[model samples]
Target: MKHEFHWSQYLDTNHQKFLSDFKEFLSIPSISTLPEHKEDIRRAAHWLSNKLSTCGLENVEILETDGHPVVYADWVHANNAPTVLLYGHYDVQPVDPIDTWDTPPFEPALKNGYIYARGANDMKGNVLLLIHACESYLETTGKLPVNVKFLIEGEEELMSPSLPKWLEENRGRLTCDFIANADAGQTDKRFPTIVTAVKGALGVTIDVITGPSDLHSGLAGGIVHNALHIMSELISSFHDKDTKISITGFYDDVLEPTKEERELCAQVPFNHDENIKRMFGVRDLIHEDNYTPAEVTWFRPNLAVHGLWGGFQGSGFKTIIPCEAHAKLSIRLVANQDPSDIFDKLERHIHEHIPTGVKVTVSEFGVGAKAYTLSESHPALRAADEALKSEMKAAPVHVRMGAAIPILATFKAILGVDVVTMGFGNGGNIHAPNEHQNLAMCYLGARTYARFFELLGTDGPVDH
Candidate 1:
């Protein structure tokens, strides 16, 4: 079977136009986490619908969900070729601390070969890449080799709360042999990487109330319990000195990593501890005992306290005992661990750990997902490997991801399909100010997608 193709040169010829189009796509601040960008989200969905239609896809339409919209498009003409469902998102993380940016977050700025924008790296650039790749194939040869369908969504940054119901209602329309989860990218351009697994997730807010209102610190200092103090104790109960989650039954459902999985994890080129410490601005690294950060990253689960607040004031101390305290908590689970089960365990733990005077409530806020692992022999992965090898001139490495992706799990469980997530992202500074994408990687990803479509179609892998 032929792996390399010259048609990717189309991306080179139209690089300038691609850049302009990508900039226009990035200009819309479709921040899903905020309510004010509702219209912007709709605008992004419409823009994608038009772009998908012009890319030679048929029956393109804007799909509505309870929260945000999902853009659907497809071209399913290849009779024997496999139908590959492509996945991406138009929603982006909110650009906070807006002053630190060298350029406006919504304004695409090309500097030093990188495009600085809010959604440029996190995924709008990726969405544009495959669309143009499809365009290249259709405009050059008039048809695609394999059937293609797009499920670009607008609430990925919000953890896709409404995606479950939407997927359930539209399951028939989304039928396909495999999925191309374009939500992730390779860490290095030198050697492409394939993510084999991603941790599952559960998010909940902890609300602790000690009384109806605040009390004077002088009056309640020793006589009454402080809400922040009680909250701190509750949080402290969740972890031990070993930096392991101390919640009961937390590890009961965790799937132990196989020997081969551990060996492969060790071989990956990564400095887990040093890199993590640097990224988090911590002097030291701490994780589960008898395991390095790399081993624990993909193999073990993690419970983290993301936010905590009880009492505060302008400049000086408030000198009052705050009656209420709140905390945002997120837990990442490995394969075989269910988020709902974990939430039940967390609630039980909280009930057992709380003090007498404190009233605690655990409200599940974000979308929860089960852990996902795609088999290495899956045809979608094989096609991605072939495409990457053709473009990078080297074989790709497979690694497991620590982050949570709700769509991968949802599609796998509900639709009974596997997803291969491939990309050309360098993978840093996303979800923060000054997020950027390498312009070269952007076009390279487009070319890679072009090659992937050809390889999948011609080889007839994952055929129905």
Candidate 2:
């Protein structure tokens, strides 16, 4: 039986309505980190709930948490049909330095074939695309091909503090045959793609206190130990001369990519020169030997010094050794690496290198482990490939992300199923000023998701 939802036909008919509704959503300024915007976040969650209910989803409600609400909806009628848990975030990063944007971030200007807004790509736009897909299915066929559920959260940007607990408490309600996360980037400006693996992360802050108070460098330069210099030495110890991460046992649990995985990654087009030119850099990327840029980003562990601060930054130098200095460091871990074990090892490494004269303290932030990956031969990958081929007239590429999505790992542990991460959007100053998402991809994503439902319904459960 050929189950077809002619989504394009309805999309053509309702393009204007879609754009208008999306603009309204983008205007909400649902920044999760700010306390003043708490009501705005709730308003966004309710808006999503209303949209889901209007699309004929049953049991729609805003599930409240300690921080923000989670909008959940489902339509699970078909006993044999596969259930898909679609995941996305309604929260967006705070728009600081608002002066840098040409148009107001909340206003959502459409220009140059893209939509420019705070959450355009990072990821309210993608969330709306999924909703639009469900609407099209309901309008065209009066029913969906498979069971669908949406788990949209309002605190994804604020470290997702509430999600893990929410999932643990509502495990029975969130169960599904598979999950689809629409929060990643595409292969390029052209081809659609699926992310098979995402890296884990651990963040730690190191502080060095040298003296009781800031002392004049000219008066006590030789007497006091400089906290800034001590902190710098500790930071330098984490990297070798070749720029490889030197933290002990960092790679002990890393699972190497198979020979076939390497071949597939190599086949993906990567012009190193083009990347360098885009970044305005004069040198190539530094990494361990025998690995491509894609491999370094997806298959390897990395340590990065995210921030450093000490003292004296006015118009001129304050001649002081400073009382204290501090730095924030983050590590991106690959598959099989435990975040707690990594954090312990890193703290030990820092302690070994601490200068004798300076007192040091270490603090650990949120720790998240890497997610398990399905093989390239998995049925979900095949269905995604077929869907992209049919909808976009192109073969989809398989890739991995260097960042961690703790929710993905949570779903794996609690629900006992691997997820399919297929979405559209390109990485371009995403967390920085002037963030944008391609209009074509936004529209194409909705069409692709509609096609995915049709394909999944026909193909049945994805064989491991």
- Give the top-scoring candidate (lDDT): 1
RMSD of 1: 2.9
How accurate locally, in lDDT, is each candidate?
Answer: 0.86, 0.80
lDDT of 2: 0.80
- Residue 343's lDDT in candidate 1: 95
Candidate 1 residues 392-449, lDDT tens each?
Answer: 7778899888888877999987898988888776535788888988888888789889
* Steric clash pairs (candidate 1): none
Task: Pull out the clashing pairs in model 2.
Answer: none
Which parts of model 2 have CA positions greater than 4 angstroms off?
A: 1-5, 97-99, 271-283, 314-317, 461-464
Hey, what RMSD does candidate 2 come out at? 3.0
Candidate 1 worst ten-residue window by lDDT? 1-10
For candidate 2, the TM-score is 0.92
